[model samples]
Target: MLIIEGAGRWTTPTDGANDWVEHLRMPDLSVGTYCIPAGGLDDQSPHTEDEIYVVTAGQARIVTPDGATEVGPGSVIFVPAGEEHRFDEVTEDLALLVIFGPAYGSRAPAHPAPLRPRS
Candidate 1:
């Protein structure tokens, strides 16, 4: 199993997925950790893959063409493929579990296999 430590302390030079450290890369999905520094610029570009952001720590206002919404720990945010989105008003470092489907440079899983049951 892959694991990352220090969600609150992880530092990045930029905002958004650029801060993300790839933990797993599969043809069906990918997972990583991203940290956006507080008071940093929000210049996130659109993505080609659909994604979900599972907030691990800190607070931020996610801005999109639609509007802005305040989010904190445990917040689940979704951004569709090719949609403009970014994080603004970051009160604290924003750490997230980013999941991207169909992996990078690969097609989606043709048939999803059943996950192994937890012991």
Candidate 2:
């Protein structure tokens, strides 16, 4: 059995560095902690694998191509692979438990399709 401790140690960004500390990795899944300081920007791009985010602390708004939602402690969110999303307008330090299916970065990055003229 595998075990991890102090998963919440990095609940807030340190020295202005947004941190993502991976704790567990397997063939089918992976887990980690993501911390962004209040007012910090989330510049992460869409991943090739599906993701689940569990808000452990703090508050923020996650904006996706479809819509946006407010997240706080105990909030659980799911994002599909290749979807555009980001967290913004953070009102407090944000800490989240992130899980990726098929393991994070296990798949090749998706390329944007060439635009086609309207028929």
Candidate 3:
């Protein structure tokens, strides 16, 4: 069994380094935790793989082609493959469980994942 003690340690105090902590890695999926500082900016651009964001703490606004939505603890957000998105208006340090299907750095499929958001 894989256990990552304290996901908060995932963030790096050092600059110019990846701060995400990957708790699991597989051929078709990966799970990780990331923390953005209060008032931090998300410089990330559109990605090739669909992603699901589970907000574990803090608050922010997520913007995409579909427009923006305020998100906070317990919020779940989805972004389609190749669709532009980013975080803004952060009021607190944001902690998230980020699931990247097929994982980043691995080859991505041409289509979005077949699964839909759970009701």
Candidate 4:
């Protein structure tokens, strides 16, 4: 069993206003806890792995190929591999629980890129 306090530790800066804490990670999958401050938008990039975001607090807008949608507490968002997506319109500092990987029945590669807002 994996356990994480994930309160003050595990924070990785997404940008100027956004930061995320890696609460859990394994060879098969990984889980992250994020905090998006007001007006935070992580760069839009293509993902090589499947990802799901569960909103824990506040609100955010997720922009994808299909379109954009508002995500808030109790809401969930999924992004398939190679999909262009981003987080925006963060209100009142958004907190999220992110999960992705082979742990979730996915066998995709990791395609990481520089964090840059989509233009």
Candidate 5:
């Protein structure tokens, strides 16, 4: 059995430092906490694996190639593999639970499939 304590896993971003703190890692998936202070920048690039983000606190707007969406606590969002996305305009201290399928950085560096336009 695997157990993760959320209280111990939570972390805040320091100046010029990464905001993600991974907690669990398995062959099928990986979990982590991502926190960004108000007005902080999310300088992450597209991932090779599909990702889901569950907003646990604060407010922000996620921008993608397709469009943008406002998010707040309890909001859940999904980003397909190789799609460009990032969070911006954080009005408050944003915290989220991030889940990656097939484990983060576990895939080969080969070219990923292009993202289809959402209907």
Candidate 6:
């Protein structure tokens, strides 16, 4: 078993314009804590893994291929693989917990039919 205290983690710099800290990343999952300063924006990027973001504090707008959505404290957002997305216009210092990784057998089956190649 692993225990992680968010407050104890060290912040790491990412290319994105926000303060980020890698909290925990086990064999089956990865987690991070992020603080987006007011008016800050995280440059858009795509991911190979699925991800979920839980807003712990502040507010921001998430831009995705589908459209833009408002997220704030208590808001939860899921981002699918290969999605183009980013955060923008953070009203206050935004804090969030992000999780993503290979699904442990405990949760669900890991493999499904392959997706068609992107056009």
Give me the candidate number with maximum lDDT.
2
Worst 10 residues of 1 by lDDT: 8-17
Which residue runs does candidate 2 get wrong by more than 4 Å?
A: 109-119
Q: Hey, what RMSD does candidate 1 come out at?
A: 11.1
lDDT of 4 by residue, 1-119 (tens): 65666643324455565776666668778787777677776764665678888887877788887999988888888788778888888775777788877443345455688799979
- Per-model CA lDDT versus the true structure: 0.76, 0.89, 0.77, 0.72, 0.86, 0.74
- In order of appearance, the predictions have TM-scores of 0.74, 0.85, 0.77, 0.73, 0.84, 0.73
Model 3: weakest 10-residue lDDT segment is: 9-18
Position 37, candidate 3: lDDT: 74
At residue 61, give the lDDT of candidate 2. Answer: 100
Ranking by lDDT: 2, 5, 3, 1, 6, 4
User: What tens digits encode model 1's per-residue C-alpha lDDT throughout 29-110?
Assistant: 8877778788766676777788888888889998888999999988999988878998888888878788888664354336
Tens digits of lDDT, candidate 3, 1-119: 76766653335434633357777778888788877777778888777777888998888999988889999988988887788998888787788888888786466446776998889
Error of 1 at 41 (Å): 1.7
Cα lDDT tens digits for candidate 2, 9-118: 44656689789998999999989999989999999999989999989889999999999999999899999999999999989999988999989999966679999999
Off by over 4 Å in 1: 1-18, 105-119
Task: List the pairs of residues colliding in candidate 4.
Answer: 10-21
Q: What does candidate 5's lDDT look like per residue over 1-119, in tens digits?
A: 87777922336777745488888999999998988888888899899899999998889999999999999988999999999999999988888899999899888576779999999
Backbone clashes, candidate 1: 0
Score residue 1 of candidate 3 by CA lDDT: 72
Per-residue accuracy of model 6 over 1-119 as CA lDDT, tens digit each: 77768732224335546776677767778787877777777864677778888888887898998999899888999988778988887877778888877531224436979889989
Please report the candidate that would top TM-score against the real structure.
2
Q: Candidate 4, after superposition: displacement of residue 26 in Å? A: 1.3
Task: Tell me the lDDT of model 2 at 102.
Answer: 83
The stretch of ten residues in a row with the least summed lDDT in candidate 4 is: 7-16
